[model samples]
Target: KGYGSGGKVTHANVFIGSLAEGTSEATLKDAFSPYGMIKSCYVRNKGDQTYGFCEFNTVSEAEAAIAGMAGKNDWVVKFANNDAWDDEVPHSNVYIGNMTEGTTEASLRATCGTYGTVESCTVKTDTETGKNYGFVKFSTQAAASRAIAALNGNDGWTVKAANNDTGGGGGKGWGGKGGWSDGWVWQPGPSTRNDDSRPEGPPSDNLYVKDLPPGITEDEVFAAFSKVGQVVDCYVLRWDNLSACAALVRMASTEQATRAKSQLSGTIHESCFGPISVKNQEKNGEKLEDHVYVKGIHCTTSEDQLRSIFGKYGTVMWCRILPLPFRAGAGSSSVPDVAALVQFASPEEATTAISAMDGKVATEFGAPMVVRFAEEKANAKRPAPTPNNNLYVKGWPVGFPEFLLQSEFQKCGNVVRLRLLDNPDPEYPTCAALVQMSRVEEATMAVTALHGRPLQVPLPPMRVKFAGKDQGADNSNLYVTSLPRTMTESQIRQSFSKFGEIERLKLLTQQGKPETHALVQLSSPQAAAAAIRELDGSTPAFKG
Candidate 1:
């Protein structure tokens, strides 16, 4: 049981588990010997069954091998300190999961390489069929943090960072993705190959718009712009009584939008009721002073032509042409012709385009295009406060539902207001509540009795002391309680007199027996309250 200090057991004994089916104990020892000295290794086998442990000369040597071997897949390694032996082994790697089928060592290295140097990249695959289930390996803490942040919770994959453990014959391991419930950190993955090319023009800021024709849906709008470029995402905003169709389009570039807007503006789709306009939305709360409105658009203009024409401008973020409703008898439909929203990079560029072509005739499209800044919406009114003084209370434990101040002090006076302070931060509990009384005297009396009771929430609990009473008080009447049973009155009075003038001390007694509670008579009630509140729950022994 006792391996000498220098002969401490090695980590190889605990680190090797579920290794590749035919791996020999000698091979495992050889792999881990580089990390530390391997005194002896034994592989248990019964009719070709391979499972066993290795012993190292020292505990530190074992720990080093354990930490380095974690997250390794080729040789399933699970290492733990021999608790019965009183040795400790620190873990140093984690598991990663939710990888794409196409994920390879090269791709993972490229993705995680930016963080730090990776010790190993092992993808666990089916032993018989060779299908990837997960990956694990060793890396510095900094690199692990970065990998977790970047790969975790990605659109297609999930990345987790945790300690490595060993078990089972299959490569399926626990830790990062499958074991932990906390969602993965977010790190953007590489864009598709098609997305590598730069846009034809400048980039434009995305704009979120509302207030659309009720009948118009996202599909109808996408069809109108499908020819231009790729559409990222589109949705219709729904409210209680109103719905607004919105679309987010990722064009070739900002320049493409300019040409697209010019060509598409004033163009009407057969289904649309009016000309569609386009303008850029501002970012970081910037105001949009200039706008471009396109009118009289031809219904049949293709998205390519639209982009080619408007792309002449500096850049266009996105362009969408509204369509009209279908007509039963007519070959084409034309009913709801509403406005179109366009986003540009800057107001100056938008204004310049508006000035050059506003109300101008379109040679290719035929219909005149009208350009103007869009109107802003009006602000809604807020409701008036309640007539009765209803104090807002927060910051009280939900279980202890009773309002401590309101219930305890309401009987003494007309309770006009009472509430607890609610905190958004979860670490701090609801410690204090507020109470307002009809009469100032009642507030003063409430502050005196329950200022430092055990049941009262401690973080400066709710008290009703007068605002200016402190300035007029002489330091003589402060009450202290919960003193150690061994403490004496003379020692208590002497210890508190330094704060202010302590007139006398009254130690509470039960059946004429001395009690731990004591009330020191300070010069004023305010001083007494202040003293009690300050020193109520401290642990230092009372000194005269």
Candidate 2:
């Protein structure tokens, strides 16, 4: 009624048995589609009868399908054999090798059917050598064992348990190919040999992990290992003869590899496929730390720009932008941002960069950038800072007109200025901006009225808050540098007005000195200090 043997169903695999001859994968998919989302539908043929496994996205979906379709159409539906899901090395599947040119999936099934019920038969050709090899999946381990014994040598083919290299006769079976060839070993099957097995030898930095769940990605494996230690690289290997995948993860050092092996080996991953095997290999991995992951970088931003922006903290060794795997929509091909990883010369530099850049919106990208160690996951969004006359608005739909945002803010108070920006946070596919209201009261009113509500219906709610700092709260006079030669007194006042009301602004020219300096006084000392902090060493490019 519920689940057989295992007590309760924890996975999404649903076994459908006693299928009619004409039933196909599409039929099973249609039957289960109404229940929930299906990840995969597989129909295996055994002579005249057929069976199938339908994998749903959740266990509830599978349970719904089982309950809905159990008695109808004379089909036997239940949770798939938990043993099959729990075991990485399934004994029911046997590997058949050294087959001649005349072999086919049909012939292999026919030959194996004499010993047991052949659930599925697959024959594949080597791309490089053009040699044919095949595998037969039986309903039970005893059937596979019987087929391996009877068909091993009688048909001039090497047959053995897929997980075991030793045939019942003690001959070289599937395990032979798993032996160390040069330095790399084929995965899916367990490795029968390890070159680094010597206890006295130095540990290796590379770890070989096999039996990863099908559909597991390289980035996922990299992330998993990155949590244990620094990951230099991750490679996922897929073989035609194997259902699951394998990975070669290179940690930063032998010590890290050892830690990864100890922590991850035989541990169940989120995929729920099964426990994976992690063993050390002879290859050397890279080194750790000083790597910072920066998210919410504008797509138009480049590695050089990242280097320039982060260079103030310390020396940047390298920077790279990671491409998005897919677009949000078919028509919306342009992405706002791509995340990047920056390598600093030291962990101190990396930490300093993270601390300074984490929630601060870059000048070019008004979106707040999230920074953390490459090995760490992204933290929760920061709380809004103290309120002021300047408001930071984000989450308006991408391509939303700047006039609309200003107009929306104008309802609360006089809109002094609004600057549109590209948001790089993948979670919010929208634009962001810095809005300056004429008064602090108006800015607070705008945030209160529109903080969690959208300007337009059906669009995501816009986030409104005061800019991180009230720049003029601390001082009244600021000595500003890097003013262009053509800049006038009025232009300086206009450029600096966003911080607060300007009391006085003057461009000072000294005899025989090339650099021009501006002395500005704002009504609010906090605003003056904020301006000083924001524009201390930068060239002031006055728009008007």
Candidate 3:
């Protein structure tokens, strides 16, 4: 709804937008509820626009969430209605193209008015040939964003960013998520992404070059800009109120954009607009695709620590580590997933950093971590989970509170359910528990890392295993890799028979060729774990 200057940061609440499908209010509460005594959390949606508003107990808590979520994930988190991101730019400017040959500006405004208020709409005409392409300039960025979404790729019209600071859509603002539009929406230059995947760093190859000598051909634009980077495509575009053609150059990445901007901008052009202004096709005052989203940040980690590690690849635009959000009202004291977003000079630099930093988690309080591409929409991924969300923990220190017991297990993941029975009397002696994690991969990881952990006072090392009722491969099945090339399934069964009963044996092949791997199902988990522990790396020699 018309974003007025009402979202005050001092109020301790922020607006989050573009939530992925399946993201529930509970998920939002679980993720952000820990930031502080969360006052409340709620989500709303219509069509592709889904968003939420959350309030924290303190400004510091809200800031912690903003810093952590800003560049880190798919959800758009911001100081609600603060107008910080909606910078002061031309309010009523837009570029609309792909029109049927005879359409005029008044016709566009009349048509676009059906979607929202249209301040100015026009057809850019060639001064020489009198050719006109469609364009529209709305009253507010919100109205413009809505108009573009409604009008672009519809019938024969296409919309893009306008080229000047004249204003951001000149009419009223829209009421949907993220204020309908931000800098990333459009900027009169190259490679503007109005729709599709979440916007990342700046447009790498999109170059905004203006004041070209009148009637400059695409080849001429390419030849001049190609010195700094490979020019994928170059074309002259006409924007609203502009009589001369402004050239748009597409570079492959930010590195190219920077190089082209530095070398080509400000050059003398014998055109009506005077000397050329070569620069990035930018919105939001930053390149949309040059930023990288990072996760697994430790509480002990600092921004400088991140800069030091990530900067090794290239110039780091910015690196910020946000404190993990915390929720006190809880069933389990589950720790939050800490994260940050680092912007690089270009997308390639970000890709390089990801390759270098992923899985290299050497933090103070936790294990080594891998970085993630900050996604505006949380993608559907299992990461490292199992088929079912459950785990079995076989260790019990009697007298431990159920919450604390859940906390210990929560170190690995969200604990959905826990069942524990203690045996103190001589009549019955057994101490064990079952923990069902919120995700299957979390359960798998818990089983992998905590199966043998000793917590200070030693009663016995914990044994964690999957508790999936019947979802996993049948108990009679085991996945064995690196078998001798010529080994057969029967041979594998014969060799592993030392441990227990083999229900079945089968060799896996690729494209009709037998591979050096086989799937064998034993009678039980104990047998499978034992066989794996004993013979996984043995590599027994065979008479092949």
Q: Estimate every model's Cα lDDT from 0 to 1.
A: 0.42, 0.56, 0.50
How well is each residue in 124-218 modelled by candidate 3, as lDDT tens digits? Answer: 76677665675565534434555555567887666655764232222121100011123222111221234224444344446655434322334
Question: Cα deviation in Å at residue 235, candidate 1?
Answer: 32
Ordered list by lDDT, greatest first? 2, 3, 1
For all predicted structures, in order, the TM-scores are 0.18, 0.26, 0.20
lDDT winner, 2 or 3: 2
The candidate maximizing TM-score is: 2
Badly placed stretches (over 4 Å) of model 1 are 1-380, 395-403, 407-412, 415-426, 431-544
Tens-place lDDT digits, model 2, residues 1-544: 2221212343567889999988877788888899987655666676887987776655557778988999789999988864232233335668988889978898888878765556668899889888788877665454565567567886578887775422211212221222111111112233323522423223567666654543344545665777788875676664322234467766777788888877876554443311111111112464345777766544334455667877898998887666554211111112223467778898888778777776454554211111111222247443546768998765555444588788789999999889987555332224569999999999989877875452542222211111212222444656555443334454555557678655444444321232344556666656755676665554454421
- Per-residue accuracy of model 1 over 48-112 as CA lDDT, tens digit each: 55554555544446667777877676555554343211111122234666566777887776666
Model 2 stretches astray by more than 4 angstroms: 1-7, 15-30, 33-58, 74-76, 80-93, 97-131, 134-160, 163-544
Please say which candidate is ahead in TM-score: 2 or 3: 2
Alpha-carbon lDDT of model 2: 0.56
Strongest candidate by lDDT? 2
Q: Which candidate, 1 or 2, would have the higher lDDT against the true structure?
A: 2
Least accurate 10 contiguous residues by lDDT in model 3: 171-180
